[model samples]
Target: MAMGMASSGRRRGNRTRRAAMAEINVTPLVDVMLVLLIIFMVTVTLPAVGVPIELPESRANPVEELPDQVNISVDNAGRIYLENDPVAPGGFADALATIRRNDGEQPVIVLRGDTGLDYGRVMAVMGELNRAGFKSISLVTDGSDTAP
Candidate 1:
């Protein structure tokens, strides 16, 4: 009877069991999501856009003294002023030619465009200056104000 019981036990052991399956684990997925969240939190505090333009205050810094510069002011009306003298749009080329002739060393052209003026107008002035052979052009800003 003992030998018969042992034979039955051996037969049960001979039966094959199903193999364990290999599958993608989700532990690494959770870790990756946490790391990405930390990275975003650390870098999200920086300023995206620059400050806007406003009028200069009384406490603004004094203008630094530089060599003689040719002042060109563009008002809101799209009118051009050269050294406080009003210059017509048609006379721009002729006036620039005269300035070029008088300047011994390439004179610095300082452009002071009003905040209310159109940006295209400013660009047009720059284009005119470039065509007139004026290479040293400096944009004059109030420095007290930021662009809106």
Candidate 2:
């Protein structure tokens, strides 16, 4: 009987029990999340979406600064750019709405219209911005135009 019991124990030992991976190995997941977070942080700090435009110069002081004010620029070719991305003339209202949503309440817009662009064109863009709930609008220009 003892030998029989010993053989049964051996049989049970031979059939090893296996368990599902119930325990989550958060170490790898956490490592990947941290790496992605670092990559995003580094990219956000750089001005990768810079729009090429020649800002008109002015003698007046600027009330708005970088990263705080939104840029709505018009190039010499009369193309409109919102935050470094081009937008169609007909889609101006839609773009402004999106910008207004992202900028939260009472956001300031800095218009960077080229000196060569038509005045009416810039005003039309401003009107669209105003319609999209932007009450404050600024024109960016070089300080050289201002009185020394």
lDDT of 1 by residue, 1-148 (tens): 3555433232346574454557879899999999999999997754221223232233345454345667777776777878767788788877778774344677878777767877798899999999988888767555445435
Which of the numbered candidates is closest to the native, going by highest lDDT? 2
**lDDT tens per residue, model 2, 32-108:** 99999999998674532377777677778656364556877789998888887899868888787776344355766
- The 10-residue segment of model 1 with minimum total lDDT is 47-56
lDDT of each: 0.69, 0.74
- In candidate 2, stretches whose alpha carbon ends up further than 4 angstroms from where it belongs are 1-49, 64-68, 100-104, 145-148
Kindly report which residue pairs in candidate 2 clash with one another.
57-142, 58-146, 59-145, 59-146
What is residue 148's positional error in candidate 1, in angstroms?
A: 7.6
What is candidate 1's local distance difference test score?
0.69
Q: Pick the candidate with the highest TM-score.
A: 2
